[model samples]
Target: MAEIEVYTERYEREHGHKPVGRRFWSFTIVSPIATAKDHFLHTEQAMTYDKALEKAMEVAIKRRSERIIVEP
Candidate 1:
């Protein structure tokens, strides 16, 4: 897997709380829905710490939004 580094501020906007330091990741994924002309659509998500991760995961599916994962 390829790993990308990002800032806490960006992570916070996607997630909620501002991250401490450089703890953001980005993964490029190809979209299957796009056609030949459109190609793939890029999607991004951010992760926070453990407490936030748990809550984010639990409600993510229902909420239909990307969330963050953090250390416990």
Candidate 2:
């Protein structure tokens, strides 16, 4: 289970569409954690893209001490 954050107003303003239904976006944020697997799975079920973005950043900062490897 993933914790999803929701930023409805922000999303609506950006896309000109209210999140009355389903909305999605592909976003990549820096994560200090080695992997997102063990962490809470933040999915659409949990929150919206905007919220997810914020949470991701927060998680990254909180787990900054953890070693992470980025792949190309």
Candidate 3:
């Protein structure tokens, strides 16, 4: 239903000592559509914070984005 362009660059936070052999992945998703009315970012002006978050999660689920494993 909702879609976003995810950045290839991944950010990570190391959880030292507390958890071993566990990795964290952070991804940034941006809107692909650019419009003059929305001032370039359609997703921001078109949807509320809750709505945008919901859509982002939906997109992630649909794409099975959690399966991604990046190696340093």
TM-score of each: 0.26, 0.33, 0.31
What is the Cα-based TM-score of model 3? 0.31
Can you tell me which runs of candidate 1 are displaced by over 4 Å? 1-9, 12-48, 66-72
By summed lDDT, the worst window of 10 consecutive residues in model 3 runs over 33-42
lDDT of 1: 0.35
Structure candidate 2, residue pairs in collision: 2-41, 2-42, 3-42, 4-47, 5-51
lDDT of 1 by residue, 1-72 (tens): 222222245556766775443333332222333334432112234444443334434433333333323321
Model 3 bad stretches (over 4 Å): 1-44, 67-72
Weakest lDDT window of 10 consecutive positions for candidate 1: 34-43
Q: What is the TM-score ranking, best to worst? A: 2, 3, 1
Model 2 TM: 0.33
State the lDDT of candidate 3 residue by residue for 2-64, as single tens digits.
333333223233322221232332223322332333221123344443454455555455543
Residue 21 of model 2: what lDDT?
35
- Top candidate (lDDT): 2
Which stretches of model 2 miss by more than 4 angstroms?
Answer: 1-36, 39-41, 44-46, 65-72
